[model samples]
Target: MTTDCSSVAYFSMEIALDPALPTYSGGLGVLAGDMLRAAADLGVSMVGIALVQRKGYFDQHLDDLGNQSESPTAWEPEKVVEPMLPVVTVRIEGRDVRVRAWRFLIKGLGGHVVPVYLLDTALPENSPWEQKLTDSLYGGDAHYRLCQEMVLGLGGVAILPELGHSLISSYHMNEGHSALLTLGLLEERLEGRALSSATEEDIHAIRAKCVFTTHTPVPAGQDQFPHDLVSRVLGEERTAALEVTGACPAGSLNMTYLALFGSRYINGVAMQHGEVSRGMFPNYPIRAITNGVHAVTWMSPAFGDLFDRHIPEWRHDNLYLRYAIGIGTSEIREAHVQAKRRMVAELKQRTGVQLDEKVLTIGFARRAATYKRADLIFRNLDRLRWIATHCGPIQIVFGGKAHPSDVGGKDLIRRIFESAAALKDVIKVVYIENYDWRVAPLLYAGADLWLNTPQRPQEASGTSGMKAALNGVPSFSVMDGWWVEGCLEGITGWAIGHGPESPDDEVFEIAALYDKLEMIILPMFYGRPTAYAEVMRSAIAINGSFFNTQRMLSQYLANAYFRPAVA
Candidate 1:
């Protein structure tokens, strides 16, 4: 409630606090939520700021042919969060647009608490159009998008002091969407001084209190506004200041560049992504801090109970999961069987498709983007069929939502449905609709193997597989993103390809994927149950123990949040 109460303020366009909220579409928002959850668990002095999407990301629907359509995901936020008294305004289309907030409290495992403020523009005092600016996540055209970012970045900064976070030691930009907050901080630095009169000391002073993290290498992931559009929304003075600061080097307002130029500490989400980012902006000293999942949230109830019985300390210290190696393989198998039974039962109840706990189940759930290649395994149905029929009986489950504007992503879902029909004779496939936070743990705990295939260098960091590992599910993926650091080759999980950013030799990768399943993974899964269980146990001990937000939060606290100020 006061400035000293929270020393660090985190800003993001979206934050996935709960499944019922539906404010988030995918990984980025979910990661933002996890960071705050971890911060609460560690009792870190931090406050979170994000937009309150009134209609939500979108509710996903798929036709029999896999044609995807979307509708607004509706919910009553009043049921969960309390409205704050603070109201702030930002200039939108040369008019004053008022912004308010809703507060949601997150409680940690240790009973500590963290407060998250969701910025909203749906106030009665605002115009009809202004009221809906924050109504949808990633909605609207160029003008609407720029205006929404203004509410998030400018209104966010203005309201923090109103809510009593003026003593904030650091302003963290979760991604480029919040980059404009730097300009707000710059305004504070200028005081009454003109932009041209601001000295290097003034710029460095603001940079000293800011930190930023870039999430992806994909061009679509970064936000950039053309010079003309920038002038209309942000006005000439801020635009001139941006041009002078080298933040608009590409002759456009590149959000990533603005944050990078404004912050003293900047990082990419993964080690490989950091290298790619360094190349993308060769002059900047970018560092890598691989992303991770929240261990307690991801671990299956059965597995949670299993750990509770053996390693009681694991609930407090995720590193205690290393003691999981000492846990009996039979106990591990029993716990997995319990979780698998629940998963099988749920599938039957929801989709009317009966599943067997004994059957080998492979799952791939992600945003149905073209680059993700969700239909990659279906690239060669003949090979997959032969492997399933000859080596073992296998079933695959798929789920995710495509961005409303992404035609390729929608086509990808349809393609997977087509592939399912073609392989219905040999392999049973089911595509779950409207996948959300509530559904993730089911597939992770029950699936025999977790699968990921992203176009090389595009996946900044994959937290889903790390989640699967917590439930004792091993990943079968390409050597990219965090997988490069997590993969121990058959120990923690198996790799699909041999190298990083390997050529798009689809045939080669497909052959390799099938060969491993037909020759090694399937045989061990069906014939050598005991040995295969060892792999599951190892996934929990090695990958699950380390790839958690607890470890991730520690990295940020020591390296970014409290980094020593340069002389």
Candidate 2:
């Protein structure tokens, strides 16, 4: 609403604009937010749209033994966001649900501001159930989910014009959750033409204005609704429209298929993910634009100050970070020491856990999903104990939240707690409770090394390691997601498990992790400090420079937003 001249609109289920605002759940929202910030930095005419989740993704609470519990983590819209004027209605379950929106401004490089509109449906004008439709994110049953998506996709399109975004030439759907925006686009393209008369040309026109990015690599992760449910939420006419647009197949409404059918340019988060997605969909041309973090936002004060002194242009042009290769290795060490000190101080204050700053600390934190294999490092406790005993003094910092419904993910956290208990005296292992955007930076910059152990091909494009790279923290991760592209062996960071196709064996992956930690990573950190610093320097010079949202948005600008379709 702040920018009436915007020509591009990016839609996602959630966006991470502020730490106080819990609208985002995890990586998807974080990536979405980073793109918008980079759009501002690049001075692009872009506006962001997402549902304003009232309860957010819930406040993750972990008990002493790592047992997880959840509660509604609500934030008042009026407090953090400014109310906008446009109030629209989205038809759900044969009733008109009133919807409103709020505005949040994201300040990017050189103080350029990008506006993000958060859609809200908690109006008093609607029914009690309708009022609570946007109350919680990822809450309720299938019906509730369909209703929320309706509010997000359908309602988002309707409000854009009222906010003076009618000239929005491109619609970039971050994922399938907002694929219904294509349906909204189809209706808008009609331009008073009868809905029944909508043809392939109309759908083609809609495709030209739309782009989609599929983030979910697993089948169960995609959203789908039965025809009965689809018919109930969306009337028969819209359901029929979906068929005409090929947005819905005969069996059920698959959100991913709808997005694929409606998009002109489709992409996966990483090259490997793109290959996997193409195999799954088979028909669509799904390309890969690897994910990245906001350089300025994710960079820690220590590294940020260092970059300011050495590479002043790094903030404006993230690619300038490649010049960080010239920065003295000792300076990298000095900054990392300050970052680790800050993290150690905070850890002691919050959890009463005092970790030695000199100890080799490895950070592993993100959404606790089964594919991530968060406990893979603890597979052989004796091997790990021997590594600490012979290799060097080591500590591990763990933090992340599992969805309330993911029983396996919750169980993984408990296993980590048990592993920590088993190795308490040998390694100072700690799991921070209620991990969020605020706690992420400390781990990224503070750790001596970043660790990721995702199951083969499941990771779409992990950005946390990229964020760590910006702060000169080298990754020791499984060769999946962005790591496949970013890993330069010992130059950027170490690798665990081989390539995506090597083997899906867990024992092999664990051995790779333990072997590297014991034989490679720990020894280098303890014995060859200067050599380790050089690795960190390359991580920033190479991975950090290229793996940033500024570069990501520039790619989107050329490939999606201002492409031939718009011309």
Candidate 3:
């Protein structure tokens, strides 16, 4: 599929494009990076705008005591992205704000230039309040976060005009974080005209040009600032202009509200999430566009090579991606086992994480959020003991960081750490600190089984589990998010959330998940470790065929953007 609208500008508060690019921290960042890569590969003109942090996010370090610590790291613009260019200046509230935006090259990836422009608030012209906008992701106080979102939304909208680009293209808001772009666009339309003089058609047309994609189903996951707080940040003039029917609410500007009202198209990240979103916002119209990963970025050379041979044209056809299954060949299977063995050995030595290469290793990692149920395994201490004592040893390695100021999230991290320390040796738990892309490949390549259990419909689309599957690591996940579509029972991995709609309604969902863990997971690890290893190999082969980013990107092109062009 192709589109006539060749250029697209994607606005997001954060994009986990790559480690070299510190604008993103987790899932949203990964998704943004995937979009950037897809735009390049598909030859779709695209630009990414993100904040330039003087403090390029916090390096979350876990102290020896298992408490999480934060350290600020800054990236040199010249060193971060090659060939730094001229700085662009934009006016924000009667002030000339100088922002340095840079372009990055994704090497080894042969594709069109997908320019990623970052706004640096560290410049001399930036006010202290403006500079504060580039603070850490999911960090600082609530009011501070709103200011940062404004920089991303309003400042980001002004970026294109500053770059000399015409406002004829569509913008994809990754989430509510970039909703301000819509307001900014509306403000541009006003152009000294009185609000009463503006036509409804003009407002609707401005909205039609914007699309909002919501990634979180959980209410708490969504950003909701106090109405009074928004007025404080954006000021009366701008805030009044944004109010519905010209009456500004004392409450914060609902990012979701702005996105919904300002966008002609709104979508959720996964099918379930779409349904959840529709239910969550019954008054608003929204559809689902499931999130996906980038096959090129995720596929390991060893595993990806299989597809290069089976589908020789995949190399040339940037969209051609097979999940990279090494089946019907004993040699390839052995190679996979050896790779897993090597990864485990290295992790065991480096992180001082004790593990049996013979014991089935499970990998669980993500942001330390309570809704994600990072501490699910610990919910059943007795079950853990059973696995440790009677069952062949099973180990789970966890890693991720909480927002610096998220005290609850910090406590969750501490809980996981304590559990890890308690279940030493037999049921070892290694929570790696300072997780970055450099170490991510190791986790994906190393795990025997990738475990994901978010509350049903809570997970948007877990690409981390998908990444593991590409590497031949089977998964055990709740029937939520992308897993609802990805799980191939008794084959790739196990699925939970089967018993009831609510995991809280009946203890059954938890029971089922644990039952599968104890009965299926434990046995595989202990009963016939070698045979289970074969299951891992087969699981990757199966998933690699279907869920690879190539297929996902193609779907988005056909269903979302390109189809409209073809029509």
Candidate 4:
């Protein structure tokens, strides 16, 4: 299980390898951790790089009115990760700042391990201001974010050699956050050459050694720093050289643009996202590779045992999950029920909400962003109350956190609370506080249906629904993100509308959501138990088998990593 020195060096801003490690804010970091875990399982030669958030991503709390509050996450990284002896330095604002690293070994099912190196800027030798650079995840101003990215990109590249990974043939930028690594590569190429000038051949050579994955489709999601800031942070000479090579444009240093220019292979996380990205950056070539979840990590213990008994090969080869259809419907129902009971008990313990296990439980847990439409289900409260009274008894489990700065996201949470109170007599609703890695699995496995309603195309590649599928829970989502491909109407799960192309898309989608729940979903759950279980089995067999990191890593191996590096 030892990786080759010439393995792919995967760089991301954060890595959520474990619940105890709060280095991740949301899906992107979780996805990075899953990718590494799968890479280890399949023996894909790779090492991951990220920043060690000492203060960690903030702990989420909410008031009685659903007003969000933030608190520092207290955890000891030394307790979880092994510290490496070597220290590297990268210049920031004309001053040399020292960087250290810690390694967390992610052991896969096959006894293979992938080492994730977390770069840290907190040291006694470094200035007090520099020491606090690695203090928080997605905290601080734009300058602070730029510095953190530098520690991950420049410092990560520098320390790899010190950690005996000098021969890394390719660098994979998981997102634009780590695009500065390309600059480190460029500097290495320009060694013994003029710093003010860079040849096309040098740029081409660096591009050949790199790959980039863009997760966000919207313009605001892309990180863009002013050119003056880039010059101040990374030296004026280096900035001028980067401009010469077309990595940093004239006005601003667009991180996504830099990555696109420096990478030979660039991809979006989903098929629709790829098309959207091509429209955004028509000049560059971009391919689509739909994202996937790590099956073993996401599967509930109850379903895990079920899969172990039925689809034994699922651990090593997730494609074997397709055999889940062979498992009896009764067995699937029992497993799902057991998982639901467990989640109910946990939710009761945490939030004091004793949800009915027999009721049709709907789960909606993701980043509480405006476009995610957390309040979409409650748009027509009168219709919702009618459905609850006539169709069936239902309970909802809401779990997610809004960014401290996003007032709109926090307002959505407040709206949900208000709706929950308004419908308290008709249906039960519970909003779980501090939605993290620990809470995500419980909600995914416990709920009868996983709900996702994003404003089309905004959701790049959501994997929460995929996790629910592994646990025998069907999704009720919009035709966006990975759901665009994973959704198989009335089979695996239900779709809200076709796509976002319709002029009355929102009207159509909300109506469809109500109609499906009232007419189909609730009736099937309460009346036809065997039929409901069959759909659950199909979810595991079809969506769970295909939407997994095992398949995704293989695609990367053939299409990106294994491609010959340029000289």
Candidate 5:
């Protein structure tokens, strides 16, 4: 499929188009995939560029002691994608590194296709070390990561003309990983003119053609390379030019700073994230385009059937999800029960632990990062046992994988297993291993409630809860990320703390979590079936309708993508 140059060229280091692809690490890639799916559904002119991970992100394996280990996740690219001939090359460390591309077409509801071109460095023309650049997703040390970024940013832009996508109107840097694309654009501007003639007008001209989305609130999450390292990798002259233009500060080559300096439009993935980002970079103007999921992709089969019968237009327009409020209470309950039964069977099949279909099932899955506070619920084991044994029979399902280097994150997983052992007799706890896109939908659709407990302001935008909402699963989370916008006290779901400002104290939040579950959530769930179903209906209607990529992509088109091209 050929794309016109007027299409939006979305550049990211990873793209999680499908679970089997393993070209993604976590939320960022998943969000990108969802956006592309929505773009196809809406028929927006678009194309995606990302690195083709050969070995892919590592597969998660746990020892008997619950220590996390990783092995290469293997898959055949030919099974899902076709290779594009005529390799492109980018200068790296004063050497030419040849890059190739693979095409994966994502078909949408109306049969519209969005072509995603994944760039790969593994080729016969490249050296052994150069070939290894694209071997794994988010692998290697700082130097390796920087080179991967170069291939994705600089090389991605260089290949567009060769791939027949040279007429791109706007370049979107999904994150700082692909910020180097700006440098390539800058180089193009300085081609005929003398380097000394480069002015602020030239910088502004390039900035007008690009937009950026910053995903993390944490300081360390952004990439920053040392000056010497950057000088060595990217030639000293080019590095000096970047410094002269104020793209790279004196100390180091801060990727996020470079992206901010180069892009005309900048946005955060959530409302709170937008505010936090602005605070982090007080000098820059940052806007919010909250993250959303592809509704049809995440809706459970049972719910899909239900929606098809009751609200047939939901698949076409997500705003039709608002009609979920008209669905009968019994019908909603039955659909959820069907989804729960399927999940229970799958869980038993995988882990040999039979979960009770009637019991309150809670799901918590995402990257096993420490800021996510995956172990917050297990903070007070005695209180948790009390809630499980005395208040209600509840089961907690955990799914996630920590990065190979994140020891603290792995420790969080180990602690969850330890807590499971301690509370084995009281409540059933199972940590699902190797969580990926295939298993995510089951957990989201099957669970009685979706749980998220991130430290306040740390979460950029948690789309997992939004996916759960699409399946009529109400969230019980802290007042953070999109939850601040989605939560409706007792209507959609319950909040952990009193509100957004309800103190960042862990003990206080945990106590509030227990109090809400024991007092409001459990009573309504066990004693009042009608009330519970109402909450489920509201979750779909209120959260799912608004927190969807249909709206998000439209916002991007209006606010970012379709802005007039630079003169």
Candidate 6:
């Protein structure tokens, strides 16, 4: 079945369609990109709206002293890293903002005409700071971040009408950043009408055509600002026009809350996350629409060719499995080893570090946030030393970035860095600076085992593990996010946490789990070669069928989009 919806506009703060586009920071962006790619492949008529930055996010550079330094990024037209398309100008907030939106005319992808519109705030007329808005994927200052989101949400709402495209069949808010678009639509409906005449029915109709998807279960990531503060940033009249909750602390309206109240359909990224989200937003009815990745775009082409040849059943039924099957067992294992060796070599060349290849190589890469427990391995220095020095030596390769203004997260990075320097060789820890979309594929493709020790329930849908699993790398993670669904007991990976909550008694549980891992997990990895291979094989087989973009998109069509349409 093919879809011919007039148009579906997808809104997000980032996109990871290609590694060359450093506009993505982590999983959320990558998922957004996968959605667009899959939509194009499925012919699910849609257009993606995203911010086009000047710098397109931070450029990480290590100082001579090995300290990370970040500054305002200026993107040259020639180095924009995207193909050109005719731009369209729109009036957003009383200003003529020129945005460079692109139309992707995909072939053999069925009916969907996917056009991704990139809004540029870097026009000649824009202020210097405004021009710099597009510099990094996640830019500076709380105010600047709010301003960027405003442009994304409110300004984005104005773009469609201004572009003379009125047949918006549906609006999909990828995350909270796009919630304000719903508000803009509300304002448009009540342009000349009085508040007394605006009924809940009116609000329902506006939201009926919209769907909001939440990616993170963590509170901090959902976006909460003092209502008065946000009102000051966005005029009171406009705020009132949108019907944002004024009951929040300090009159603040949480963007996620607004998204929940403003949209007819709301979803979380994973099954467990969905359950947690329903509880998180107790007042509303939230549901789950687990995220997935596009197979053709991410899988190695050789793997695709292989799947089409051998696994014909999986080829059509499970998009990810079809591609993964292409990778012969030997070929996958050898590629993983080679990628890790190369990554280790690259780290040595870049950071002036050296180490033996025999050491158990463990990878930990993600945003330098506290809940992620990026410093879990260093929980017990002495035990870690014994494991590294006495038992088979273990080496950790770390890479990630904190928002430029997140002092706490940055301090965490520094703390981890110091710990790495102390460990030196036996437990060698090397952080590859400037983490972005480009660096992500390398980390996932190279690591022997992906280590994710986030405080349970904090992680939404950690797709990095999926990427790593695809390359035949086993995972060592907490029992949260997508891992809960992907992990097979003693097969695909290991889990530390029992579930989402880390009770007071189990505060040291992950730490204890790692200790066990140091003694048992590390040894099992080295001693049981055949078992390890089987585990790796199982992970790809399981996740390749379950956690794929095509499957997720198909479900979405049958359950969310098409079901609603037929009803």
Model 4 over residues 1-567: C-alpha lDDT tens digits?
233474799999988889888889999999999999999999777889998999988999999999999999968778888989899899899999999889898887778778889888889999999999988999999899999888888998989988878788789999999998988887777875776567778778888889999999998898888888888998888788667645555588888988998899999999989998999989888988899999988899999999889878889999999999999999999988889889999999999988999999999999999999989999999999999999999999998999999999999999999999999998999999999999789888989999999987899999999999998899999989999888889899999977645554888889999999999999999999899999999999999999999999898888888775332
Write down the TM-score of every candidate.
0.98, 0.98, 0.90, 0.97, 0.98, 0.87
- Per-residue lDDT value at 528 in model 4: 95
Q: What TM-score should be assigned to candidate 1? A: 0.98
Every model's Cα RMSD, please?
A: 1.4, 1.6, 3.6, 1.9, 1.7, 3.9
lDDT tens digits by residue: candidate 1, 166-192: 888899999889888888887877875
Off by over 4 Å in 4: 1-6, 245-250, 500-504, 564-567
User: Model 5: how large is the Cα RMSD against the reference?
Assistant: 1.7
Error in Å for residue 364 of model 4: 0.3
Model 5 ranges off by over 4 Å: 1-3, 192-197, 564-567
The true-versus-predicted C-alpha distance at residue 479 of model 6, in Å, is 1.1
Worst 10 residues of 5 by lDDT: 1-10
**Lowest summed lDDT window (length 10), candidate 2:** 558-567
RMSD of 4: 1.9
Model 6 lDDT tens row, 1-567? 112334677889987656665556677888888877777776676777787665766766665334667865454544543444434443334445555443333332555456665666676767676665556666566666667777787677766655545677678898888787876677668886754466887788777878888887878776766555566676656667544343244466677877877777778888889988988878766778777766555554333455566565553356446345445666556655666676667777766877556656788888887788788778677777777776576778888877766777777787787787777755777788777665566666666788988777778888778777765677888888888788776778887757555453245664666665766677777887656766666767777667777788777666655445321
Give candidate 1's root-mean-square deviation (CA, Å): 1.4
Q: Across residues 1-567, which tens digit of lDDT does each residue of candidate 2 receive?
A: 444667888999889998888999889999999999898888888899998888888988888889999998888999878999989988888888999999998876667778899998888899988988887878889899989889888899999888878788888899999989988877777876767888878878888888999998888899989889999889998888777655566568899999998888998999899999999888888888899999999999999999999989988999999999999999999999999999999999878999999999999999998889999888889988988998898999999999999999999999999999999979889899888899899999999999999988899899999999999999999889999999999999988877887768778878888888888888889899999999999999999999999889888888877875322
Least accurate stretch of 10 residues (summed lDDT) in model 1?
Answer: 498-507
Model 2, 318: alpha-carbon shift in Å? Answer: 0.8
> Which is the better candidate, 2 or 3, if ranked by TM-score?
2
Off by over 4 Å in 1: 1-4, 501-504, 565-567
